[model samples]
Target chain A: MAASNIDPAIFEQLQAKIDEEGRIKDELKDIIQQLEKQGRVTQSILSRIHNTPTGQLGPAVFQPCERSILTQIHLVKVLSDIASKHPFYKWNNLWTREMQNLIFCLQLRHWLAHQELETIEQVGNELGVPINVKDRDIFHLTIEEYLLALTNTIDELTRLAPNAVTLGDFSRPLQISKFIKDIHAGFQLLNLKNDTLRRRSDGIKYAVKKVEDVVYDLSLRGLLPKQRSSDDTPAEAKGGAGAPASDMDSDVFLEG
Target chain B: MQMAGMKRSRDGPKPQGRADWDSPYIPMFENFRAELDEHHDRREKIIKASRDITASSKKIIFALQRVRNLGEKIPPPLIKSKEYSQHTSTIHERFVSVAPDLKGINAYRYQRQISPGIQEFMEAVLFRHYLETQSILSPSESAKLISENVLLTEDDYVLGLFDMTGELMRYAITQMATNGELPASRTGGRGNILTGLQDLRTKLEALDVSGSYGLSKNAEQKMSTTRTSVEKVENAVYSMTVRGKERPKGWNPGMDTSRPVGEVEG
Candidate 1:
């Protein structure tokens, strides 16, 4: 298709979305800056914890760690902002838990920075969480894993509040199905051996298939497209070989 | 020794073998030797001619390069001038004088001024040449093809463009981070970028327009995977940037601001 033939409405919408994304990214830049300042204090605290033995605690247990406190407050604020902006109907408990974990990390950083090593165990005990750095590799969690977790949490929330997440106005589910089929065809063409490529293709195909199935079910229930299989065929021919002809005719018409 | 002496005696000089040895057969023998030498030379010349033909044949006999550049490299002859008749006569004589066994001679000799067909052939050859030189299509060429032919809206075009741009940015950021010029961010934060892109894609799909631009299942999945790798690079950049912030001097949070937001407006 030529660029001249592009659907103007869709183009406009896409342009709007792109613009919105740019704005969000700018906002994130400012947020990252604020977070970085807090990150410094958190890093110091983490470093201290690293120095201390598992069971031992350092001195200076009562001093107020301004930076660490500020870091926790900043993190909570960010989490709240994200939750509010999230399109999901209900914010998942996982987000809250993640935020809490962040707070603990901040507090742990504070303990280390102030040389209040002895209080580390106490702080962990009070929070009912173990300070097993070796076992809990918080720092090692990859971004992909983190995003997967976040998306999964969002998915769960969407499931809980289906009405909150508005269904896309277009036939997105069908597009997704088509996309999956194309990807499968592409993979067959490339004949790649890389496991990563295979897995990626599989993942896309699965997501598209899922969306297709949902759309199909919705269409069957008259929640999506109103046209029914019986609407096109004669009642007597509905259950017989003639049914296929009706389907073919509809498909041909739709394509045209 | 006795046998040797007897042989010598038998073969004793016979009066110089007949005065001047001028028998009639003498002239015949000399003539025969001369003819034999001529035959040997002729055979050699024939062998040399055959070798020349074989060598020329082994090499490209036809000027393939000239044929390849027939229209573009060579100028077509002017046919309407006073020299037309003379030129035609010369061409005719050259054609008639060439080897009779040559194939496609008539077609070759009938060539006229360069036409559109010739131009197209030349273009195809040039295209093949470009392909050989470049080995693969350049990104710009790919983008041009996509923009001109792919059934997509301006939004889809822009989105695909940004997708490519984002990949480049991520690569740069990763390189910078590795060089210790940028900080890598925390893990979960990187997904925000992918999430943002995904949101845009989802929104685009939600539009009511028929046959909007979208990912193929394979492309979407590949995109997802690519997104993860990009996120990893983003994390590294964020980490480096955050780490850099710890240093009192040269810290500027605004430096990490994402740009071109206004330009993307619908």
Candidate 2:
């Protein structure tokens, strides 16, 4: 078969899409920076509250007013951009979907950074379970069991994104779903080691006496088998044993 | 009898080269041939199944390619600002018209005269400023502070509170943009900025600056005093104008109420 031809128009369109996506990505970095600055402002507010006289204010006074301000500011900015960029209702749905996805990413990143493997696994399992098989036998049964457990969990989580406005298209990639499941399985395997009995056993002390005895026996006997069949017969007689005795005698007499 | 005799003459002698029917090897040879036929049948079935799978996969790939082609033909949604700049311009004009007179209006007096919506916007701005500078209190400690100092109900205050926060985020973005950091948040949703701000606040709370610095009491006192002064500046910017007959109806002390503070004046 001949190779297919590429369409220039399609290529150009795809290139344009990529360029736009790149611009957005660059813009996102700036947005993150803005968020960081807003966060600093909130932190300053929080510090002030922390330093305030205890008797003067209630415990709820430190609920991060500045942080809330920053959050509101971020929201308004986003809204303004959306209002400017999108038609009234159309942008709302897109924004909601984007926000939900962003929040999920943030949560996932948080769990990953803290080494919270169990939580990560739980989230992944709740989304979908991926199965990975290895050559080792000891891990076989447990891995299979965890995979089954994860499958059940993911079935439940798959239902969650569909209903959420913000989580639109989250389940578009089957590969990603499977990857998440596999991550869960990996986390479960990591946790499984904590309960393994092989880790607890000290085989060295238990087998020491038997090992010494085997060593002593080996030293005395030098690893030889019992006597050989050749020891029973003279070397010359053995050669003639395969032939008839009379024939052998005649040959011998002739030779003499 | 003559016809039968003729038939026997023609068929009487079997061909010398032909294999005997009674030979034992004939049955074994037949069995082997039958087995070979069965093996060929199985092989054919496997090939057919593999071909079917390949064809199905090819069909799927073709369908995907078609979808991709169609997607390329579709244009991206038009950006809202670019498409509807006129609407924003109108809103901007409105804000400019009202801003000058806003300074002369006292919070209480303005609340009585202007539409409830406009007054609400102003109050929200003040509260947002208070929150941004931590002039009021910590979010954690605010319920107690609210009980003592602030007289407004939670329901009445929430909108203004969120508005103020949104304003502050806008200010932050503007400052950053002025510094050539990045463009402001386009959505103006408030929620996204709030979440980001909260996350930052949490990180700051975890810092062990006190343990690292290890300052004496006098030095600590001095530092506290300096912090307090900076906080007061933030508070002054955030507070609402005091109303009096002699002082214009909305005399905002921070800056000229007629001019938008952050805009680059030509």
Tell me, by lDDT, which candidate is best. Answer: 1
* Highest-scoring model, TM-score: 1
TM-score of each: 0.22, 0.18
Can you write out model 2's per-residue Cα lDDT over A1-256, one digit (the tens) per residue?
1111112342233334435534544554455445555544543453342234322223433344424543735553654453334222212222333232323332332322231223323433432322221221111112223323333233323332122112221111111222233333233222222222223212212222222232223222222111123123222222221233233212112221
- Listed in order, the DockQ scores are 0.01, 0.01
Q: What ranges in model 1 sit over 4 Å off?
A: A1-5, A49-66, A88-256, B1-266
* Top candidate, metric DockQ: 2
Give model 1's docking category: incorrect
For candidate 1, the per-residue lDDT at A3 reads 12
**Per-residue alpha-carbon lDDT of candidate 2 for residues B1-266, written as tens digits (9 for 90 to 100):** 01222122121111112233122223333443454344345334433433433333233222222211110221223113343333323323443443332332111112222223332433333333233332322232333322122222222232233334334344333332233221113333222223333333332233222321112112234334434433433343333212222233233333435556444221
lDDT of 1: 0.33
